[model samples]
Target: MSTTGAPPRPGPRPQGPQDAGYGYDVERLDPRGPGRMGAAGPQRRRRRRPWARWALFGLSFLALAGGAVLLYVFVILPLGFGTSLVAFTAALLPVAIVLGAVWWVDRYTPQPRVSLIYAFIWGAVGSVALTFVIGTPFTAWISPSEPDQVTAQFLGAAIQAPVVEETMKSAGLIGLLIWGRRYIAGPIDGVVYAALIAGGFAFTENILYFGNSFHQAQAAGEVAGFWQTFFLRGVLSPFAHASFTALCGLGLGIAAERRSLMLYFGLGVGGLSLGMILHALWNGSSFFLPVDPANPLGGFLRYYLTVQVPIFLILVAIVLFLRWRERRILRRQLAEYGRAGWFAPAEVDMLVKLGARRKAEKWASRHGAVARMGMRDLIRATVELGMERHSVLHGKPSERTRRRERELLERITTDRRLIGALTAPVVRR
Candidate 1:
């Protein structure tokens, strides 16, 4: 039940290296005396190699193109123009809701827009495209010789779909972790990116389901079927995919923090495996429910209430805890900067709380656009600075990290100067 804005209580001073789950000695950090980084002196800017960026951009383009082709062939051709359009519009509602929640969770330490977009595209287009490429043929090959339609559908939904879809989605996570390493500062970042990808996948998948249901209902003269499908998928279980994928993201995030290659693989596999299992169980539940003539959906409804609802609630709790943990990290790390004179204690307090940060930004708006923009950038950079320090303290205490620290310090200094100059007292001679 930790809250984002609750002020951190004072704790015992660090006695040695073991503190905050890292090896770094918080005591050893130099204050803002002469020749210290707290002064934010000029430093050399390092130029990042562009190959990863270019390669990622190129791959995203191909995936998007391929996805468009698949969309036209599979969804549009089968469902017709009007139905597809309706499905597309209907599909947007849940996607928007899920994406908004993810975005809100990520607000503490906002990631780069480009990276977020890449994650979404990978989920929406790349994963779906790959699933189509592999799933159709593989499913056909594995089809049982005994022609039991219900059994076949159950196998496809419970077995093939989970394995194929989660794997394809995980590929995107792996790519992001490899090429866009800087974007994922911790577990929350991992969740944010993973959820975005899931949101994208769900969007396209929903379109197919809704379109098919719409057309099928029309043909069967049972228009209620489409609405029922919408209620079940759209309202009742929109976040199902996101919850599953977030476990993988959580693993990736922990691995990123630990800076262990083995963990990157081990945890990634472990998380993906867990996700697949959960997905399978979720899909399999409906197939195995005992038929009750009195209440046809009694079993499914009970399972949804007892199993699905609790899982979703638990995931929501975990996300909230993680966000609160993020706030704590910012407060702890920024307190050290405060002691070093890089920031005031009041400023540190303002930066960690969402409400205070918003008020500060709003207050700055009265001074004009530059001040407001400077405030926003300063908040973002300050959060980044704290996260970078957290990353260093975790396991990556390399020279590159040191360089990033200096860069952030300089950027913060420049922002402070810009904002200060705007409100500084003018002297008239």
Candidate 2:
């Protein structure tokens, strides 16, 4: 919007009389008035926001994306080749899809594009590269050193993997906050972003593991172990990254939001340490301190997720409750702005409830698709605009912030008028 300068205006000139001088009033410029100022200079080129600053996102995506492909091709392909590639691909589908969705959602805001791109790269590339180098030896060292042959595999499966994998998986989330500080928000964002990266890593890794399972089945001359492991990894473990990464995210998020530097560091570091402990406990849960000499740990592989699953669920419950609280706080904040006449009471009510918002959009849809979409946008924009108003009440918003808010509401509310409906007129001065 600042790309164009308004047209110059003529001012009245005054000559002083001997006895008294008269002051002249010059009309102030009206930005929206149809004329040179409105239509000619700033409007023609209509420069977009400094979205150009984020154009680098495209390049980051390309560079990191190629790396993901190469890793998958060389590492994952070999692992799956011995068995059935189809099973690997099938198991990978959900993880891959969820990762992409998370990536897309993070883009909706003017977030630090590099931070997000790095998050993906850190997980898919950095974390993977670390684990491949670190995990191979742990496997070899532990392989022959199991409990009674009956429980040896469980020790390697439970204790070995969690200690090995969770540390590797958590590195990306930590790297993101340390190196890419611009994008990290509260615990919620930390979880979501970390989970995305972890999920992406897990998905790619799962394909390889599943593929190897198939290959091992071929070696054993068994058909069922491949599918059974495939089902377990594909269905059960795709969400594992999301769960584990969320713990780290929660820690980073708490630290990010804290005003006190000491407290922030302490809380965040504590949370991350807790996450590591959780990972160890989860991995080792399969074999508790063994009561039987035949079993190194008591429970074995069956309890790895089962033990951690409840903790993950509790974390999820806490996250949901926190999110609901945020939504309600936002709703209450916006409803107060309705008192200023910018929004109608009905509109505020609809914005506060998901169901009310949906019904309002559905009602608007009978007129036209564009109208319905516009109304939906209007409601959302109004809520956001009201929030911006609160920020403005406290301090001056930059021109870009103001322009963006105006543009969003204009696009939405304008469509509502064109559809022969008006939700509410602008508030009176």
Candidate 3:
């Protein structure tokens, strides 16, 4: 972990670096090696070929670009830009809703914005493109020579769609786990990232469905089909994809904590399988449910109420539990620093409690913009510090983590000085 010179004490100032008058040695707080750079620092050297990594990056960029081109040509061009624009506009509603839900869950220890954007783009573009490439052939291979429309739709939605789409979406989660492992501390982070990717996928998929419906309805001189599709997908089941993929994220998050490769793979595969099963179940239900000619959605509504609603509720409860676990970890980890005099107990309470933190920010905002910015930085650094300490307490310690801790502590120190308006929050019990 990182430690810095404590704030000035009431008595005389400490004489040396080791004795900053906190009653504890700053060096002792961080058992890791010092990062002080002397005058004669080592010179930078150019590295030799990192060809494999660069090749992978290039290939990925090319693949996504190709996918975008295919999407524009095959999907968007067929619908025409005007129709696609209308679909895109309608799709934004559900995207905003999912994003808001993810943001609320990710309020504590938020992941990097760049990483979140990558996940979203991969879900929207890369996964959709992969689905086009793999799903078309696979569906053709499985379909009978003389296929009926109903059978083909069932095969595509219940079997092929679930298998293909979930696999493609899960790939984004796997990539994040492999490349952005440091950002994923636990299941909450996994769920949040997975939800973002699923959200993006849902957004793109909605545009296609919405566009198709609108075009068909326009040709028939009726808006019923388009409105019906929107009601089903947009109003009722906006989070369906997110719910399914979050299972995979939950698994990958648990996988992140494990050192064993087999265990990690096992858990990840398990989560993906669960997500696929739920997706298939959801898609297949429409087929099994009896549809009345007068009331088309009678059975569908019953299934949604009985099955899908419960599953969504259970997922919500699990997320709440995970968030509570995060709060517990923050309290446990920061309490050690609080005891060491690096943080006041009230400050720790403020960091863990969103209500208290909000109040503090509101207070800082009354002072000035600088004070507001400083308060935000202070809260963020404090959260990161707790997470860093938690990482060290677990078996994943490294020098890089220590360096990050030092950097975060330095940030916290600077922010605390700037945020002089709010020292310790008067948190409610």
Question: Which scores higher on TM-score, 1 or 2?
Answer: 1
Model 1 accuracy (lDDT, Cα):
0.82
Of candidates 2 and 1, the better by lDDT: 1
Write candidate 1's Cα lDDT for 96-156 as tens digits. Answer: 8898898899888899887888889888888988898999877887887774898789879
TM-score, cand. 2 vs. native? 0.63
Q: What ranges in model 2 sit over 4 Å off?
A: 1-53, 80-84, 93-126, 133-186, 235-238, 255-264, 286-298, 301-306, 364-369, 379-429
- 74-162, model 2: which lDDT tens digit per residue? 77766645354665566567677666556543422224445655666667676676677777688667776544764666655665556
TM-scores of the candidates in the order shown: 0.86, 0.63, 0.82
Off by over 4 Å in 3: 1-66, 144-148, 258-260, 365-371, 417-429
Worst 10 residues of 3 by lDDT: 31-40
Tens-digit lDDT track for model 3 on 1-429? 336787655763343322122222233243222222112235444454657655665676678778888888987888998899989998999999999999999987788776787778888899998898899899998899989999999999998998999999989887766664666767888899899989999999999999999999999999999999999999998899999999989988876655346756887889899999999999999889999999998889999999999999999999999899889988987777766556756678888899998987887787778888888888888887786566555555555555667668778777765564243324523
Best by lDDT: 1
- In every candidate, how many clashes are there? 0, 6, 0
Give all candidate RMSDs, comma-separated: 9.8, 12.5, 7.6
lDDT of model number 3: 0.80
Count of backbone collisions in candidate 1: 0
